[model samples]
Target: MKLECQEKHSEIRNGEIHVYAWFFNRNVYENNTNVITFNKIKSERSGKYTCVARNKAGFDSDAVNIIVTYPPIVWTKDITFNGINRPRIIKCNVSGVPNTYNITWRHYTNNNQLVRVFNNRINGVLILPEGETNDLVFEDSGVYRCNVTNGIPDESGNLWQSKKIQVKVEGKPVLAKPLKSTFIGHFNETSSISLFVLSSSNVTQAEWKAAENRNSLGHGCCSSTVNKTSFNGKCLDMSGYTCVFLIKNTREEDFQNYTVDLINKNGRNTFDISLISSGVPEVPSITDIYQRQNYIVLEWKPTFDGGAPQGFIVQYRKKKDKNWESIRIQSNETNDFVYISKLKPDTEYELRMLAFNRLGNSSFTVQFTTLFKGETKDVWTQFNLFLCIPIVLPVCLFVFLLWYRKVLHDGIVTMTKVWLLDTISIFLVTEMTYIPR
Candidate 1:
């Protein structure tokens, strides 16, 4: 294929004439001649081609569109439609040159017989039951094939392209197996438990209730209706035939065996699930510590709540003091940091942090020295130094000086001197160690 642009004469004159340049789809064609040639072209090369003649005064250009034609390609996928009572529309996706085409729909039956369902110029066909208002039946389930042709033949000389779709029509309500039957939740937290049902028709009525006892009832529950709006829990309609029982705020009493009853015209079914309590929360870790004026701000990252709603408790005390000051945070609070105000500057204080729920609590402890009123360095650095000194110094002194001091002093004064030198070296090394900011 080739494209050529001829120069046309005009009365207006330019300073100097230049060579012609060629372009395809707004991109420069490597060939700078007036004609663009292709030994063999594919569909991708079809687009607008332009030729431009330039001079010192200005430039002029012209363009022409190119198109490639191909045979029809039909695409289809298997579809499963629940609620057989409803009408459905089945369609095949087709793409090719010449938008106009004829579509043929055929069904392959269980007896190995081929039957033509529809033959028309439309892309899609509506499927209904035998009667105008009748419901679809299981006999409607089969392999439906769609053939499309636009009067164009492929390279292999095949005029029609075909695709098949497996249609399934189901009936009766049955339990859709759940991944797990038990859910762990915390008190005062929100939880949604889902129960899926597969049926040919919509679930006209659904009942969500708590069982008096799970051990006594094997399939059904004695109704302590939790689906009412007045209660803490309610039934929510979900897509894909799922019934969700949402507890807005779970309580200790809400942790029990639950049942979901699904009812349609054809049949009814029930499913059971259990909501259990979680254990104590994991220990909290201090993520950051800084000082502002006389106030110390401590930030911590909360750990897993063991499937329950949890809150934080911060306790702090002066290093020389025995009693601790406590600050409790509620679960609904969003603040991740606690501000300890009116603290003595340049004084070391021990801090204890714990996460607690109704179940129990876990705690972590650290020590930080407050910064001076106008100090810029953070309390985190001081905390790091304090952590090393208090822990290492006491343990080292107790093991080396207290336990072996008498023996060395009675017989080997040189050994005692060496031990004292080692202890001093250890203390200096610890003090010089890098402190976390």
Candidate 2:
């Protein structure tokens, strides 16, 4: 049965139009009580209406009522993609009514392309007792979405509901695990050590640390990551140096370390000295003092640091200057020296060099210096004979003399005289016994 709104012309008529109704399904109908209803109606039929007609009753009147019609909105777009070469669900929603509708699937690609996809109708009204849910899966791991709408509407009639969603996919790294290290040569006997690194990417940092025997020689090598997998460690063993080695990849954010200490011994010493590369500055030594020159050219023995060093840094200042001046030079090995030539001839300059590493530059380092013609004020401050004799030697000698006099002085005198008498008797006997020509 269906109930429809209608217009009435006279007053004394059936209570209302009973065109169609589920409530009026009763077989028996009262004399003038006609009511009708419909399970559904055309959305266009929404509006005011009046029922009319009169039978044996005077003029007919009408009562106006409205048929409310709300339709489900329609949507056409759906589907999207992600950056990882993967698919993902796009955030989307559509406005509509009846809340009960058939949701059809369709795909609208981001490239301004379209494709129609199909899934059986989703009768949320039948599926869910209350609300509706639209869940979608990635089609072949690419991208997709669903279109939703009811079969009818208020104005145009059929409507649609739809939204787009994206899907994603990603792959794993090439190497599954960390690389294992290989131990190279004789640990303690190597005069100089070298390190070689081979990697899948450019290395930014490289350095070595050692600890073994009783003394460990810290690195004195330039630290860098040339990363060829196989390169010289270029480690110089200091005197009495023995230790384990630890290689590091400073290029990495967290940095990866290849530690050999586990196979070696547990030591507290870390030989982390930076080596001088070719052209790199060495410990500065000045020679041939010149009185006429205000500043002296200081040279340092170049370093044979492991990696290529961009250059050397030299710092100096007049003995009276408030600040210091610095100079840089490019280098590649140890034993090379730099002659800082330009200077104020009369002024004394205190010079030093700082070594830079992946960790940062070494502090105001004294590894290098320029020889300066020192003022004669205290030429022998360290070798002052007066200081030793008056302060140290005298005090020590006085102590020894007192100890000697108090302890063995008497015994020494007696023993000496006795020995002298024996010598004299022997001489007398010799004279008496032999008259030689």
Candidate 3:
């Protein structure tokens, strides 16, 4: 590529004229040259070129633009079809040396069958047949190819360039098999329910909603009254041809007619499923008990939740006390054990724990006694005394015999008195004292 600047004035002013050429503000040639030549031009070399001729008198500058053209590069903007029977436009972006080009549209079906859509020398937009007479259908869903050519070839010498546009015809969601009308879920536990779809048709969203109903009233489960407000649960999973809904930490209020709404561009469809409880929880049993000073640790194995979440109510009272103290424990709080503190030591207590759900409660009574603080101390003291007696008595007897022999050799008659006095002093010093634990 070459760019030249011609001198216009004939007046020979001052000094020899110096000419310079610049491409996009960078000097490409200098010194008495009015023409700039670019070797091996590329797309990057296409831009503005400026030429300046300057003398001792002054300087004059001019600029011109240069464009390099290549073969057509084609791409399409994403297009969404509202639903079956909707008219849609697939547009492509095309760029090349010549603005005029021939566009060819082809579609590949699911079975890899090729079908021509259109072939014409026109702008890069294809409009599908619209109206009720020529409505789009699910069969029209496939990969649409947009190919363009303008005689110019790319660096690889390929005359045609193409882009694939995904065309999907959305419709109402269709279930593969009818979902079960009823589901059994446990309260205070995670429940996962799913449904299969034959043709999701681009299911964009799924929602789970529960109908208004009264809370479960008694051991007779599954009874409902329409006196409450409806609520929504989280839609756990929505992918491809399946929808999974989750009821986390299920509650009594969750047992109702649940509506699963599947939504798409075309429309939405709702499926109904009734959730019911299994039954009343089983009676809780105490598995183990640990007694401490002024406190007791009770451990129990969890029983059946009876199709619903269940918590525990612990009731206890001192054997002599007339009133019972109660503690409510939530299902999540019980890690197999309950700590009952601030109880009187050396007192007999009766405890009963019951598992209750929305339906009813079942219980069993147990009795345990807290140990007196000094009781453990006394045991330890006795243990220490028992160990000391055998060793201490032998040592004392040996020492007394030696002293008696020495006193007899010295002709002293007070050996028995001294021995008795020493024995009494040792006993006094070795007396068991209460040790705080």
Candidate 4:
């Protein structure tokens, strides 16, 4: 609690000093007119108060002796995770001073999301569920923590503890068919990726990444992964795109490989790309790149130019790996809308696509990040400028200054003398005339 002093003063030479004081706690007034009466009360508000009085000579007395107190700790009585209904009870030790302590619980959601459950206190402890001591119950489950604190009554004031509770959320991952790989000549064509995700768990995220510059000697561009919400997964680059994923209902029997082949569509075309993706489709020749939300838009020109395509499919895989896993992404956009979007941030991805026509399908792939942010390079612009002055120039100046000091100490000298010899002997005839003068 805190008190704020508000006093007005006036003087008039009256008889004796008469002091009047009043205290307020919102409407209800208190007659604590005693000059030095105060207690160490635990309140929500405490501040200074005013006392007014006239002296014998009509001088007024000022307010004095303000008091301040600390507020009591807030006690939480219940713990709720995500929602109101309790799912399963978690067994844990329930130990705390029920008289002063309060407990609150935060529950994890079925989809790995965190939510706080609220409840009004019944007894002291957050009304534990059925049988267990501190029988914490949860609807959805995961790792959860509890906040227990001994509020105001705990005179020592330091009373808060959090205990982590691990939950065994019962569920499995759902999965879709893995994509097939493509090959060009003996050099190995770039691989592509495609898939859908469904799960007992909330599989709300998809990702794809590949090793970079992996020739035979191998840099680091061989492995990548993909994640998506039960639909077209991250579009991969044919250049380097291989990875796996597990969704809600994934089981032990699901670990396997999927493969696809590339067949030339139009024999007359130099590189015929047949929609070989699926069903009724001919080969495509030219490919186009476009962008779309969370995916790369890939379309190819029909094998027979001007012919409408049934549909377009993009393919990709991680670079330089034996497994050579593949995934294919589908697109509804026309051949013109070839842009791909929502690739992994700061990643290198390759892409290829097959266009379906009356004859067959044509396939082509390339590599680039879906993100427009170009790769960053090691730039020394700012640091280089600083080093030139503070480090380079100063060191050079010190060297030159030392060299000059050495030259000064070495002591090299040059001198000149004045003397008249043979030229003055010829002028001796002037000596006699000068003596006479």
Candidate 5:
């Protein structure tokens, strides 16, 4: 509040005119002339007052009134609303000059247009306090400003004081991306399953359950962790809170369906993860391989199925390389043979096989190398026997016939010489078998 007082005289003493002023009927200024002012004003300063101008002989008195006007203060804080709960009401606390203060509430719509809102402002019938909103909805969430003014003219404009309240509508836990239904873990190795849960608040309570019992996973073999963050397209514009479960030193018994229950003030939801353990199938040993043009057909004894219906995967590469190329066979039944084609001619290659199922994959069997071309030859083969027999038989027959003729000629010459000496009439005595000359 400001005030001015002055005395007009024909002459002035000490270059100033003295005036007296009384605030609320009390003398507050007596030595000042031409001006009396209250620099700052408060509510308590509202009252009647008077100012007097005095000279040596006479004094003039004038009556005046002073009224101090100020702005209202709004008592407010952050507000949260549970959309699922009934009778959701928010209160606005305001204090100022009692009858002079007017508290008005306004909020911007989605299009940013200012609109007056009256949400159950009546008393008794409506639980929401005056200048507040009731039955909160997601659409009602925004920046709410309470403008308090006493309609009194002051340095500050029409708005005396303003306060903003951030209101958010929180609903129950809704699963945006739930836990995976199936998980695979290797024997003796640690495995983890993670779930992405979206909630309105940072705090969410989670529990593990299995086999119709609560907390059955136990602390020694199982553990879990949670992290809160914001996500973009996949989370549907909501903040994503992730929870992960770890199984240590995985065993066969750990292969089962585990449930995770999440709860908050909004609501509750549950999801499951099925864990399975897989081991390598038994080593595969080769029985025989038939060679074709740049291809080979392989036959083998079926190895152990490793506790599941299994299929085979064949991998091969050059003998000098460590990187292997693979061939996949999609079948659950055991296979006794597989035909491998498209091999490089004259190139040495090492090959291996593995068995796999939905549970897990097996370790690769021991590697075997393919034979190069023209390396297969046996002395007992039919081609070698026919070539050797014809050349050897004629040489043996010629040597035996020469030896028999020499022996027969020598015996016949000796017998004829002895018989001719006595042989005038000897032809009748001994009949000799004729020898051809």
Candidate 6:
């Protein structure tokens, strides 16, 4: 704390100035006569301090109060445990000089949300200057922060240690996701089987056993025993427990369900994996399309069922458009045609056909086109014009001659008379030439 001169007038005005300062009713200083200062301030420096200035005119006085605040210090190390059957306690170990700060516990969830843990309990989270988590799970593993704040106000004050805590809880082995009842794999193709275990557990050995028929390859082909890691960026093992199985070449005899057995003193957990063939169905093609007043009918044919029951799917859209409308065939239906009603008139649409089964879908997409009622009428009119052109042209010329029959008869009579005169002249010349010869 510091105090300044409080004299009412300077000594230059012929009035001598003197100042006095003291902690209210505590200590006083007269030799300084103008200002008071402290080398260091602490909790003890709190309370009121008074200042007085004297002159020939009289005296003036003023007072001020000082207060100090500090945050609590905490440890930065992580709190860890081997396993939990009951509650586990973790202390914050915070210290404040005057014991003038409050303790608050915070739990950071897996989804990155902060929840206040107070009053010694909230679900699995408990708070009392220490954090206690009961029946911990893999989701409970995250950052925990212990915050402290004194009632005092200071701009430059702070805690002396780190506030973040990393908590790790170990427990029994549990699957991240349940295995499927059946999986599809191609013949003679490589396949992968992955299993994830949460944290560290009592299970020490993980083994895979093939069906009785495939006993020739004993112990099955399992590889890449990942410890404290994840597979394909999923099933992250925070406690280092994961196993993977890889088959180089699948065979028909290996189509049975394989069992994975995990053994330890605690007990044993087993899961079976069934494999099936993923054969693709044959491609389907659209054969015919008929347009009516309010709807269009489409027909398609599929060649083979690909060793399984097949279903057809029809998709269509406007010509040169980006969006498409789809129709799924029913599983019980055995026919190959579908009626698509409620269509716009005079519009052009492109259709696609394909077939699928439980194994896989066909590799090809058959494309076709459908014409609306007005568009079909335009096609028929063009065909009629071509068929009538030969017959109509000759009839049209005959009609024109009948409208001008008199002019046509006069011209024909004149041409016939001229031809007869020319013939006569040619005959006379020919007879004269033969006589001269």
Q: What lDDT tens digits, residue by residue, belong to model 5 across residues 1-437?
A: 45666555566664543446454557464535445556767777676667776656556777677655556656777677665544545556665554456555665432344434544232212133222122232434455666666665446565656677676668655444322477666677787766666555653566667745556553222122233222111222333465667888987777888887777666666666677665556656667766865577777676765545677788878899889988877755456777777766677778788777666677777888985463345657655456544554454445544654565666754657445533622442222222222
Span of ten consecutive residues with least summed lDDT in model 5: 228-237
Q: How accurate is candidate 1 locally (lDDT)?
A: 0.68
Deviation (Å) of 101 in candidate 4: 5.7
The number of clashing residue pairs in each candidate reads 2, 88, 2, 90, 2, 1
Query: Highest TM-score among the candidates is held by which one?
Result: 6
Which ten contiguous residues of candidate 1 have the minimum total lDDT?
A: 225-234
| Deviation (Å) of 312 in candidate 3 | 79
Task: Put the candidates in lDDT order, highest first.
Answer: 1, 3, 6, 5, 2, 4
Cand. 2 Cα-lDDT = 0.38
Taking the tens digit of each residue's C-alpha lDDT, what string does model 3 give over 179-277? 356777777987766666523255666676765543222221111112111111112222235567677898887777776777766677777778886
Worst 10-residue stretch by lDDT in candidate 3? 223-232
Order the candidate numbers by TM-score, best to worst. Answer: 6, 3, 1, 5, 4, 2
Give the Cα RMSD of candidate 4: 24.3
Question: Per-residue CA lDDT of candidate 1, range 1-437, in tens?
Answer: 88886657655466545678878899988876777777886667778888897777878899999887777878777777655456676778888777778888887643334534677847555464354222233335567888888888888999998888887665655543223578786668787675555455577766776777533322322221222111001122212355666776888888888876677776666667799878888888888887776677899988888777899988888888999898999999988999887677677777778899878887565655443354456678777576876566666666665545575567656866777767775775575563444
Model 6 C-alpha lDDT per residue in residues 314-402, reported as the tens digit of each score: 88888879988889996579888997876777788888877888877886576777676542446666655655554555555555446
TM-score of each: 0.36, 0.21, 0.37, 0.22, 0.33, 0.42
Error of 1 at 213 (Å): 31
- Model 1 residue-pair collision total: 2
Q: Point out the higher-scoring one by TM-score: 2 or 5.
A: 5
Which candidate leads in lDDT?
1
Cα RMSDs, all models: 21.3, 31.6, 18.8, 24.3, 31.8, 19.5
lDDT of 1 at 122: 72
Write down the lDDT of every candidate, Cα atoms only: 0.68, 0.38, 0.66, 0.37, 0.58, 0.60
